[model samples]
Target: MEKRVVVTGIGAVSPVGNDVDAMWESVRAGKHGIAQITRFDLEGQKVTLAAEVKDFDFGDRRAAKRLDIADQYALVAAREAMADSGIVSGENVDPNRFGVYGGTGIGGLATLESEVSKCVKKNTPARASALLVPMMMPNAIAGNISMEFKAKGASFGIVSACAAGTHNIGEAYRNIKHGYNDVVIAGGAESVLAPISFSGFANMTAMNPTTDPDRASIPFDVDRNGFILGEGAGWLILEELEHAKARGAEILAEVVGYGATSDAYHITAPDPEGEGASRALEMAIEDAGIAPSDVDYINAHGTGTPYNDAFETIAIKKVFGDDTKVPVSSTKSMTGHLLGAAGGLEAVICVKALIEGFIPPTAGLQKQDPELDLDYVPIQGREADLKYVLSNSLGFGGHNAALIMKKYED
Candidate 1:
């Protein structure tokens, strides 16, 4: 028999707000987090806007001078998530039964850039700042999170570019389900609003040209140019079913199934037909032991890119086929695209959907593209009774991940 995995808590330091309540309010109210670049100067970049985390102070979690922003963000969000799980002190919480798994697509880019500049001007590397490996390495999210909560069961990172968050959660779900650990801190964090990061994405033409935050990230819309780069950290606590019951933990949502696949075709683009993604979705449904018709809501990885929207729509249609049982909405339309943190943040949205039983609308969706014919809860958010929510995320480098979150009944 396999152990069941359930989400006990969620925390997010997103572009819009600091914690889950504020962030979800911003998302539910259709507040756009994208704005003119303020983290650094983006005067000449074609894309001068991003969905950046605002008003985030690392606080007592760590001294500002001691850690990189990426790791700080992870710790801050992890603090909230651990508290939400009702196990913050980590005392009496079995250290040997807890673990950490986190990721960041572009970890601590700002720190790396500053170090490089110092070396070039001074003709010698900064020995004091030499821990740049741990600062900028993608695994730093996991390392920092482990230190914050002293999770000692197991720890690692999943670097799947943009799909990192979802990948981390799915793999963490496996860790708990297979009895590798009873609890896992899983998610992704990112802080890549640097000159090189922005220019590299812009040069590839994968960024939204719209300067208006209100309309910048409109996935599946006819007028969408591309994704508006976004940044944040989202963390969730995945506790084993038996453990959660014993601890009297509040079950946010049950992670029923997780499916992942590789496009094997492109490092930057998905297959035109979305065949790889389509298969992943099907596998997820099967793993959940649910028919396609059982899924009620789909939180799509709609990145507002022409190819991503069209391809994702085709993939959704493939999973549901003629049934069309699920209503799809892309919260990225409001949060912009969080890259490595996309899946983690989206997973929080799904869990919230199951908790609140309301599906958030896809903001900025004024006119739909004919290519995306499925019913998108567009324009305004909706209040609905949700039973199961399938969250999907496809990353660059041909990585695709799907997770099914269902209302916990038992």
Candidate 2:
């Protein structure tokens, strides 16, 4: 029998707020989290702004001392999610049946940069800490989460650039649905607001150079520039539906379908025809056994970049037709682009929208792009009785992912 997968708990450590409730409230209000970059000196960088998690404290002295920023963010969010799901100490759940899957675009870049700089200054490799390799590996986030929660089942990392977060959660959904595991902790985290990362992105012209917070990330807007670097994490506790119900877990939403594809066109840019992204969307809708029109909302992979927004718009039109009026919005307009964490955070937002009956807006969208004609819930949120929501995440290397979520029924 095919098992059903459902989301029982969510946790977020974002730039807007440190916790899920606070972040959701800010998102609902269309608040912007972007501001001056504080992680490093931005004197020579073209992009001086970012959405950085402010005043973050893990509250565990050991974790604070040992973990990298991304690992710390992942651990904190995972802890909150596990607690919210009432899976205390693995008493009711088998630790081996639980799993961890995490994603990150540039895991522990800050730590790597620091260690390299120390080695350079000391003129010897001995200056680097013994923990540097484990701390900087992309898999560290998932490994640490698994160690923290004692999840012995299939713990691993997903590293598909910006699509990584969505891929992680999507893979976790599949794991539970196929009876591989009863519960999975899945999400993405990133903390690359350091000097090297900032300079690299700025020089590549991938980040918005605008300094104004409100104007920095206007996705799908006429004046859209580029994405704003954001640091944070989002985690969800996904479980088999029957297992969750048996434990009296408060089901948030159902994971209906997932689709992932590659453009094979450009390394850093989306396919001009948007074929890969369109196919992913079509596959997800088909996997969900629903027509495109049945989807009420879309959390777009709108990074506020010219190529990304335009290509994504073309992809949406291709999947749903040009005239289809499904309301779409990019929470990145407010939260900035969380990169690998974008899909994970957006997935949480989709589930929340299904539960809360309100669709968040693409904040700062004063004037719609004349080229793109779609109902992008602009400037403000709207009350909507959304049943099924789709979230997209397009990454570098042509990676595209789409996830379809439905309000839990019976």
Identify the candidate with maximal lDDT.
Answer: 2
> Which residue pairs come into collision in candidate 1?
none
**Model 1 per-residue lDDT at 225:** 90
The stretch of ten residues in a row with the least summed lDDT in candidate 2 is 84-93
The model with the greatest TM-score is 2
> For candidate 1, what is the TM-score?
0.97
User: Model 2: per-residue lDDT, tens digit, 104-212?
Assistant: 9879999999998899977888878888988999999999988888898999989999999999999999899889999999989998988998888888899889878
Model 2 off-target regions past 4 Å?
none
Question: lDDT of each prediction vs. the true structure?
Answer: 0.87, 0.91
Pairs that collide, model 2: none
Q: What is the number of backbone collisions in each predicted candidate, taken in the order shown?
A: 0, 0
